[model samples]
Target: MVMSLLLALPLAVGLWLVTGGRALAVVLARRITAATAGATLLLAVATVAFGAAVDRAWLPELGVRWSFGVDGISSPLVLLTAGIGVLVALHAWVEVPPGGSPATFLGCLLVVEAGALATFAARDAVLFLVAFEVVLVPMWVLVARYGDAHDPRARTGAAQRFVLYTAVGSTTLLVGILLLVATAGTADLRRLADQAGAGLGSGTQLAVALLLVLGLAVKVPVFPLHTWLPPAHTTAPTAGSVLLAAVLLKMGTYGLVRLPVSVVPDGFARLAPALAVAGAVGIVWGGLVCLVERDLKRLVAYSSVAHMGFVVLALASGSDTGLQAALYANIAHGVISALLFVVVGGLKQRWGSVDLAVRRPALRETSPRLGFVLLLGLAASLGLPGLAGFWGELLAVYSAWTPAGDRPRVVFVACAVVAAVGAALAAAYALRVAGLVWAGDRPDPEAPRTPDTTGVERWVIAVLAAAVVALGILPMLLLSTTADAVARIGGAR
Candidate 1:
C-alpha cells in the first residue's frame, strides 16, 4: 500500500499544485515534481525489496484482488517508468517556459506516471485495464494544454486525434475484457493464465484475442492504424513526445505479452501470420515515409513506426527467442526513441523550427556538446553495432530465422529479410537527417541563429545517450530479467 501511494504521490501533488493557482504554483509545482520523483525512486527500491510480494485482495467475491506484485517481466519496466518520470520532471525544470503555470502540466505528467506504474504492477485484469485507461486523459491534457502554442490547432488537433484513436482501442479492449471475465468467471491474471487454454473454445478465444490485439495495435499504431501517431508526436511538447514514445507506446506491446498470450494462446497462433505481415508492412512503409519527411520531429515519429514494427514482428514469431527479442526491442526502442525526441525538441527550441530544409547547416558549431550528443542518439536510432538499437533488430531477425514452435519458417525468413532491408532504409534516413541538419556549410547571413544547448538540456541528453550506450553494451542485464516472463508467456502456446 505504501508502495502504491509512493507511485501516486506525484499525481496527488500535481492536483494540489493545479488547484493552488498561479501566484505560487511554479514553486509548488517544482516541489511537487521533486517530491514525486523522490517518492517514485523510493517506491522502486521498495519494490525490489519486496520482490514477488503479493498484497491483499481488493474484491474477494469476484476473486479480483489488489494483488500487486513484480516478476522479472514487470520489474524492469517499473524501474524504467520510475526513472523516466524522475528524469522528465528534472528536465522540465529548464525546459518548461514560464508563461502558464507549470502546475497543471506537471500534475498531468505525474498522473500519467502513476497510471504507467499501476499498469505495469497490476496483477488483475480489471486493475490493469483501469490503469491503462487512466493514463489517456492526463496525456491528452498535456498535449492539449502545453504543446506548441504558436499553432493552437496543433495542440487541439493532436489531443483530439490521440483521444479518438485510443478511445476506440480502449472500448474494444473493454469489451474483450468483459467477455473474458464473463466466460472465465474471474479476472485474476494469474488464475486466468492457468485455466484459459482449458476453458475457452477455439472460436470464442480467437475473437477475444483479436479484440485485445486490435486494442493494443492502435496504441502500438501498427501500419494503417498508425496514422494518428506522427501528427500527435510532431505537435506534442518535448515531455509529451518522450512519454508517448518511450512509455505509452510500450503499453501496447506490453499488453500483447501480458494478455492475449496468457489468455488466448490458440488465437495468437492463428493470428501470428497476419500480425507479422502488418509489422512487415509498417517497417517498409514507415521507412519509406521517413525518407521523405522534412520535419525532424515527424521523421522521428515515422521512425517509431518502423522500430515498433520490429517488436510486433518478434512477437508474431511465437518462439522463446522471438518473445525475448520483443521484450528487448521494447526497452531498446523506449530508450533510443526518447533520446531522439529529446534531441529534436532541443533543436526546435534552439532553431525555432523543425523544418529540415528551412533549417540548414543544422549542426551548432557553438554547441559541440549538443551536436555530439545528437550524433550519438542518431547512431543509436540507426542501430549502430555499439548502441542499444542493435540487439533488438539483430535478435528479432535471429529469432525469426530460427523460431521455436509451429510458426511458418518461410514466412518468418521472408519477414526477417525484408526487415533487414528496412533497417538499411533506416540508415539512409538517419544519415540523411544528420547530413541535412549537421553537415552542410554555414547558413546564409539571413538564416536564424541557432542557440547553444543549456546546462539542463545537455544533462538530459547526456543521461539518455549514456543509457543508450550502456544498454547496448550490456544487454544481458535487461535480457536476463526479461527472459523468465517471456518464456512463461511464450511457453503457454
Candidate 2:
C-alpha cells in the first residue's frame, strides 16, 4: 500500500496536470506540484524505512507480476529520485521555461519523477522495462516543447535525437528482457538472481548479456553512444537539465547492475574487458572535450561522461569492492552533477549565454555565492579530498587496478592507468572552469555583473551543496546502507 501510493501520487497528479489542469495559473500549478513532490518524498522515506513492498499478479498468462519494492540496492536511488523531484518542483518557483504552459511543464517533471521512482522500485524484469519506458515520452516533451526558447530548431533536433536514440535502446532492451524471461522461465528478478543463470547455456547467457549491455549502454550514454547527451543538455531548461544529469542517466547504470551484472555474471565477465576499455576511453574523451568545450552547460554535460566512466570501470571490475565502488560513484555523481547543473543552468538563464571563451565579469566579484558554489562543485568534480567526488574515483581506480581473478589483469591495469590520466584531465578542466568563470578574465569594474543566486534557487543550491559535503564527510552513510545488498549480489560469503 505505501509502495503503491509512492509511485501513484506523482503519476496521478502529473497526468491530471498535463490534461485537465493545463489551464491552471502558473503560481497555482507550481504550488500544487511542489506539494505533490513533497508528499511523494515523504512516502519514499517511509517506504524505505519500513521496507515496504507490493507484489501481486498482473499478467498470469505471461507469468508477469505487479511487483514493487526497495532494498539496500534500490533504496538510495528511490530517495534520490523523490528528493530530486521535490527540488525540481521547488525550482518551478524560480523559473518556468517558456516553451509551454507552467502546468504542463510541471506535469512533465512529475511524470518523469514517477517513472524514475517506478524504475528504481520495480522487482519484475518486464515491469522494470515498462517503468523505464514511462519516462521517455514525458522527457521528450520536456526537451522538445519546454526546452530552449531561443532556438526551437536545435531543441527539436535534440529532442528527436534523444527519443530516437533511447527508443532504439528501449526496443533492444525489451527484446533482451523477453529472452532472459523465456530462458529463465521466470519474470521475478529475485528468482532470476537466485538461479544465477544456472540452467542456461553459456551461449544463451552471452547473447542476453550482449543485448542488455548494448541497450543499456546507450542510456548510460557510454563513450560512442553518448553523442546525443551534450546537445540535449545544452538546450534543456534548468529543471530539465537537473533531472537529466541527476536522475535520467542513473536509470541506465542501475539497469546495468540489476540486469546484467547480477543475473548474467558469467556473460558479463566475458564482456568486462571490453567494458573496461570503453570506460577508460570515455573518461579521457569526455575530459578532453571539457577542456576545450566553450559552452558551460555542455562542458558540464561532457563532464558527466567522464564521471560515469569511473562508474562503468568500477562495475566492470567484478569484485565486491568494485560493485560497492560503482554504487557509491553512481550516487556521488548524481548529487555532484545536480549541484553543477543547477548552478550552470542558472548562469545560463541569467547571462543569456554561458560561453566561457567570451570574457565576462568575475563571478566571485559579482555573484560571490554562485561563484563559491561553482568552485565547490568544480573542486568535488576534480576529486579534491574531503569532498563527495574524491572517494568514488579513488575506489574506482583501485578496483580496476586489482580486478576479479577471472578478469584479464593486464587489460584492467592498463585501463586503471588510463583512468588515472583521465583524473588528471579532470583536474585541468576543473581549474580551467574555476579560472574562467569563477575568477573572471580581467578586473573590469565596468563590466556587467551577473546577479547572485537568491530565494528558492539559492536554497536549492545550498541544500545540494550541503548534501555533497555530508556525503563526502561520511561516505559510510551510503556505503554501509548498500554493503549487505552488494555482498548478496556479488555472492560474497
Candidate 3:
C-alpha cells in the first residue's frame, strides 16, 4: 500500500494538472505542485525507512510482476529523486518558464519525478525499463514546449534529439532485457543477481552485457553519445536544467549498477577495460570543452559528462570500493550539479544571458551571495578537499588504480592516469570560470548592478549548499548505508 501510494500520488496529480487543471491559477498550481512534491518526499522517506515493497502479478504469461521495492542500493537514489522533486517544485516559486500553462509545466515536473522514483524502486527488470521510459515524454514536453522562448529551433532540436537518443536506447535496452529474461528464465532483478549468470555460457553473457551496456551508455551519454545533453540543458528552464542534471542523468548510472554490474558480473568484467577507456575519454572531453564553452548552462552540462565519467570508471573497476565510489560519486554529483545549475540558471534569468564574453560587474561586487554560491559550486566541481566532490573522485581513481583481480592492471592504471589529468583539467576550467565570471570588470558607474539571490531562491541555494558540505564532512552517512548491499552484489569484498 505504501509503495502504491508512493508511485500513484504524483502521477495522478500531475496527469490532472496537465489535462483538466491546465488553467489553474499560477499561485494555486504552484502551491499544489509544491505540496504534492513535499508529500511525495515524505512518502519516499517512509518507504525507505520501512523497506516497503509491492509485488503483484501483472503480466502472467510473460512472467513479469509489478514488483517495486527499496534496498540499500536503491534507497539513496530514491531519496535523492524525491528530494530533487521537492527542490524543483519549490523552484517554481523562483521562476516559471513561459510556453505553456504554469499548471502544465509544473505538472510535467511531477510526472518526471514520479517516473524517476519508480525507476529507482523497481525490483523487476521489465518494470525498470518501463519506469525508465516513463520520463522521456514528459521531459521532452518540458524541453520543447516550456524551454527558452529565445530559440524555438534549438528547443525543438534538443527535444527531438532527446527523444531520438532515448528511444533508440530504450529499444536496445528492451532487447537486452528480453534476451536476459529468456535465457535466465526469470525477470526478477533480485533473482538475477543471486543467480549471477550461474549456468549461462560466456558468449551469451557477453552478448547480453554488450546490449545492456550499449543501451545504458547512451543515456549515461558517454562521450560521443553526450551531444544531446548540452543543448538540452542550455535551452531548458532553470528548473528543467536542475532536474536534467541532478535527477535524469542519474537514472543511467543507477541502471548500469542495477543491470550490468549486479546481474552479469563476468560479462561486465570482460567489457570493463573498454568501458574504462570510454569513461576516461569522456572526463577529458568534458573538461576541455568546459574550458572554452561560453554558455554557463551548457558548461555545467558538459561538466556532468565529466562527473559521470568518474562513476563509469569506478563501476568498471568491479571491486567493493569501486561500487561504493560509484554510488558516492553519483550522490555527490547530484548535489553539486543541482547547486551549480540553480546558481547558473539564476544568473541567466537576471542577466538575460550567461554569455561569458559580455562585460558586466563582477559577481562579487554586485551579487555577493550569488557569487559565494557560485564559487562553492565551482570549488566542489573541481573536487576541492572537504567538499562533496573530493572523496568520490579520490575513491574512483583509487578503485581504478587497484581494480578487481580479473581486470587488466595496465589498462585500468592507464585510465586512472587519464582520469587524474581530467581532474587537473577540471581545476583549470573551474579557475577559468572564476576569473571570468566571479571576478568580472569593475562595475561601470553608469551600468545597472546585478541582483543577488534572495527570498525563496536564497533558501533553495542554501539547502543544497549545506548538503554539499554535510556530505563531504560526513561521508560515512552514505557510504555505510550501501556497504552491506555493495558487498552482496558480485561479492566484491
Q: Using lDDT as the measure, which candidate wins?
A: 2
User: What clash count goes with each model?
Assistant: 0, 0, 0
Q: Which regions of candidate 1 deviate over 4 angstroms?
A: 21-23, 52-54, 97-100, 362-364, 445-448
The digit string of per-residue lDDT tens for model 3 on 304-347 reads 99999999999999889999999999999999999999999899
Find the number of clashing residue pairs for candidate 2. Answer: 0
Clashing pairs in 1: none
TM of each candidate vs. truth: 0.96, 0.99, 0.99
What TM-score does candidate 2 get on C-alpha atoms? 0.99
Off by over 4 Å in 2: none
What does candidate 3 score in Cα RMSD to the true structure?
1.1
Q: Who is ahead in lDDT, 1 or 3? A: 3
Q: Between which residue pairs do clashes occur in model 2? A: none
